[model samples]
Target: MARRRRPKRSNKEARRRAIYLLPNLFTTASLFSGFFAMIEAIDGNFLVASAAIFASLIFDGLDGRVARATNTTSRFGVEYDSLADLVAFGAAPAVMFYVWALRPLGRLGFLAAFLFAACGALRLARFNVQSDSAKPSKHFVGLPIPAAASMLAGTVMMWTQTSLVEPIPAWVAVAMVFVLSFLMVSNIPYLSFKSLGLARLRSFNGLVACLLLFVLVALQPYVMGFALLALYVVGGPLGARLLERGKAEKEQAEQLEHKPDHS
Candidate 1:
């Protein structure tokens, strides 16, 4: 029998092969989750929509880790991730929230959502440009897009799961729209987990804490997610203050160490 010939891969084909599959799959899933969340919101399933948004967050977190682990991180992946984020974290949430809660407030509701979407885009743009030299100090320059979206989603989940009086109080929802939108564009610093890679091992105590957190989340997912998102939103200002205080103390200590002896 004659030997069978294998088809040759072109350079472009070879590059395509290098892209990771599992991670990209996760990314696509995240994008779909976000898209579905929007559909759920429009269908009046606010609870499901909110939950889907959070689910998207999980997928987003997984994609990067999977890519890194598989050595498949690439410029294409990065670009795709950002685009998905804009749709999932920025546009979907804005539209969902506006129609769900903010719509009652008339034009102001949509305006706030619009601001959030615009600010989110700007934030993503800044991140892309500054990713190389971004500081890992105690905080981020602005509220992360994902975090902002999570906050909104978490709040909705909290209200729904807790059987709270209302899924979203008109006043609170309005205020939140403005607050979240501002945070997205503000100069406030927030934590970035990028430096804390998945490989970092925690102490036994930390492991216990993680277990406890898991339990709490399992027991009261709505409350836990709500508290977590709220804490993270507050964490920015708190972290910034702590960073400033630490800087001041360090400067003072250095000055004392270098002071001349009176003797």
Candidate 2:
């Protein structure tokens, strides 16, 4: 009997499918981390749960970059990423916070957690719609859900690890949750840092700054991480306000300069 031959197209299809799975694998890892976070939170392993959420953040970041690099971007991947983000950044953080800090607040605690998750979902939906219709920009239309989650996670990690840090009051935790949830759904622009072009940087000062940042972070990961995330959360509104003020002052100067010689 003649030997049977497999078609070359089948091999190509298999290879393509494998490539596509690479990014989705990262997405799966992120989802698993988020699920693990919730389980750990329930088990009273708050530190581990916080760390798991951070791990999910890493995986979540990698998936999109991997997809882009591999030319495997698809609508399915986009939708999948968003869904995973809601689980990892939205539900996971909410559950972690509720268990670790918000539990004492009773109904108010759970409600704050719910608000965070709901705002995160709404933020993701808005991001998806904007991404499809709007021109690419360096800023996000609202606080990214992952960043919000990371802020909460960083707070937990800092509180758990540092002796100098005081325990957050119940009301303060509730307020923090409410603020983060509002920021997620707000229209304030947040720097996405996507166009920073760090890979293509040639400045020696930039390299030094990057090295210094790494050293600082390495020395006190929990404290430094929380500080950096807090700065980013505050920077959005501060930057916008500064820009608006500058524009207004420039317009005023122009108006004065153009005034007739009535004076």
Candidate 3:
């Protein structure tokens, strides 16, 4: 009997094998979640759309961690992740919110949603070019696109879950989308929680505070997400200004103290 020969992998097949599977699977799931959100929005299921956007966020977060942990990060993975983010965190949230609240506003509503998605795309592009490098910075250069999307998703979820007498005004939703869009592209320094090292807090009080915060979030998750996003979005610019003012004051004081007494 003749010996059976195994077929060899071609160059393209080799290249395909080089790409990471597990991380990309997560990214695909995120993209699917985003698509599902969009479909839900089209079907007039705002609540489910909001939830899908949140689910997309979870998948998006996992993809990077999985890639990093597995030592399988690659250029293909980075590009794929960004594309998934654009779909999941950019288009899905924008469309979901628009259908939820902005639909009644006509052209203004569509423009607002378009702007949010556009800004998110810009944010993702900037991140890929600048911050996506291996060097970790203390803070993000801009409000992350995911965070902006979360702001939308969390707000929708909050309104849907909570009992409120008056429905949220359409104008308010318009203004919020506009603000979030700009924030996504702004140069404000948003804290990167990934760099915070919360696990290694210096004091017992810090741990207790963290635990208390977790409990609060558990109690009122929708409120907590919305509240935290609001704080973070507003805090970025305020924090930047304060930091600059402090730096200028410190420099001025140092100059005064170092000056040879001119008296």
lDDT of 2 by residue, 76-157 (tens): 7788889999999999999999998899889999999999999999999999999999999999988999999999999999
Residue pairs in candidate 2 whose N, alpha carbon or C atoms collide under 3 angstroms: none
C-alpha RMSD in Å of predicted model 1 compared with the true structure: 5.3
Which 10 consecutive residues of model 2 have the lowest summed lDDT? 11-20
Q: Quote the positional error of residue 205 for candidate 2 in Å.
A: 0.7
Q: Give the number of the best model, judged by lDDT.
A: 2
lDDT of 2: 0.92
- Where model 3 places Cα greater than 4 Å from the true spot, the runs are 1-17, 132-134
What's the CA RMSD for each of the models?
A: 5.3, 5.3, 5.0
Off by over 4 Å in 1: 1-21, 133-139, 194-199
lDDT against the true structure, per candidate, is 0.85, 0.92, 0.89
Model 1 residue 189 CA deviation (Å) reads: 2.9
lDDT of 3 by residue, 1-263 (tens): 99899999886656545778999999999999999999999898877998888899899989999988987777788889899999999999988888888989999999999999999999999888885554778898889998888888888888988886366899899999998898889988899888888767799998889899999999999899789888988999999999999999999999999999967
Clashing pairs in 1: 140-190
Sequence-dependent TM-score of model 3: 0.89
Worst 10 residues of 3 by lDDT: 10-19
| Tens digits of per-residue lDDT for model 1, 1-263 | 99999999886666545666788889899999999999999998988998888889999999998887877777778888899999899988998898888888888888888988898999998888877676546457899999999988887777766767655777889888788888888888887777554358568877787889999999988888789889989888888788899999999999999999999
